[model samples]
Target: MKCIIVNDDSEMRKTIGKLIGHSRGMKLLSVFNSTSEAALFLRDNCVDLVFFDIQMYDVKNLEFIQNISERTFVIYIPEFSPFVNTTKKPQLEQLSESTIAKRFKKGVDEARIFLKLIKKEKPDILDDYFVI
Candidate 1:
């Protein structure tokens, strides 16, 4: 699956990018230091997944995720407990900050399952089905 990482911390970005590089069937398309940069990329590219930080300085996490294409899955890396509420959205998944390497593969597997289920249930669903 094609993917991107969005995080303000350079170290976190490197960590996640490396994890993606090592994962089977996963491709690291790009890494951005902020949500706005990722958003701009999304406008022209069609990636299958995004690893996004839930708290960023440039954009509101909820709004950014809500606006992205539904076909593009999001795995959130939340920085605070309060931001965990964003996972209430059915299509959104959260990766535990404590065990990123352990959880990354699980999150990707879950996303694949979710896309299959959604396609089975509504074959004609638009890519914009993801909304707040």
Candidate 2:
């Protein structure tokens, strides 16, 4: 999957970029410090996944998130992000600190797990995947 990292912290961006680079079945497309910049890139291109940071230094991500295509999947990077993981969307998931350092070392296991869920559930943005 083609992906990008958008984080206010350059260090974090670098870290995630390196992780993505080492990830299996994943490619690092680009990295951005601002949500708007990432949003602009998302407009003309197609990416299978996005690694986004909820806490940004310049612009808020709410509008940016709204601007992206529904087909794209979002993997939130911040542990303190505002989103509550109540949805049954297979494309959405949060990163935990315990697994951050070992994420890529484990061959992008988290992303692999999420992608497996996506394949099994096929959750779309417009509709709920689970009805029960």
Candidate 3:
């Protein structure tokens, strides 16, 4: 899917962009430091997804998202970033299959509900992501 990263913080933008690049199902189109730049780009482009920062300068990210075509899917990364340290890796790795399955199911259920709303309206944008 074609995607863009919009974040005021350059480092945050890079981090999210790298994650998107590593994802097997996404295509990173471009990265923007401000909402206006991204808004202008979207005026004439058909982007499938946008990795948007929940907190952006001056312009409200949510409002900016609303102005765009509803056909676009946005995965909002809140400013309160989750600090996942190396210490958590071992514990996470020890998760049982059922535990993993439960988490996956919860994510899928939320996505299904969101998609249902979109399908009733745009019916075109179907993207999913885990909000940490």
**What lDDT tens digits, residue by residue, belong to model 2 across residues 1-132?**
888888876667776786677656778888888887887898888886777776565556789888766555666666343334554422223545445655434434544555566667666623642110
Candidate 1: residue pairs that collide: none
**Which of the predicted structures, 1 or 2, would earn the higher lDDT when compared with the native?**
1
Candidate 3, 1-132: lDDT as tens digits: 677888877766766666566555667888998898898899888886776777676446666877866555566755543334343423333445455445434533454555466767644444443343
Candidate 3 whole-model C-alpha lDDT, 0 to 1:
0.63
Task: Tell me how candidate 1 scores on lDDT.
Answer: 0.73
> For every model shown, what is its TM-score relative to the native structure?
0.72, 0.65, 0.62
Could you tell me which 10 consecutive residues in candidate 3 have the lowest summed lDDT? 84-93
For residues 1-132, write the lDDT of model 1, one tens digit per residue.
Answer: 889998887767777887888888888889998777778899999888888877777646667787798677788875543435554532223635555666777788877765776668765655434321
Candidate 1, superposed: residue stretches over 4 Å from native: 80-98, 118-132
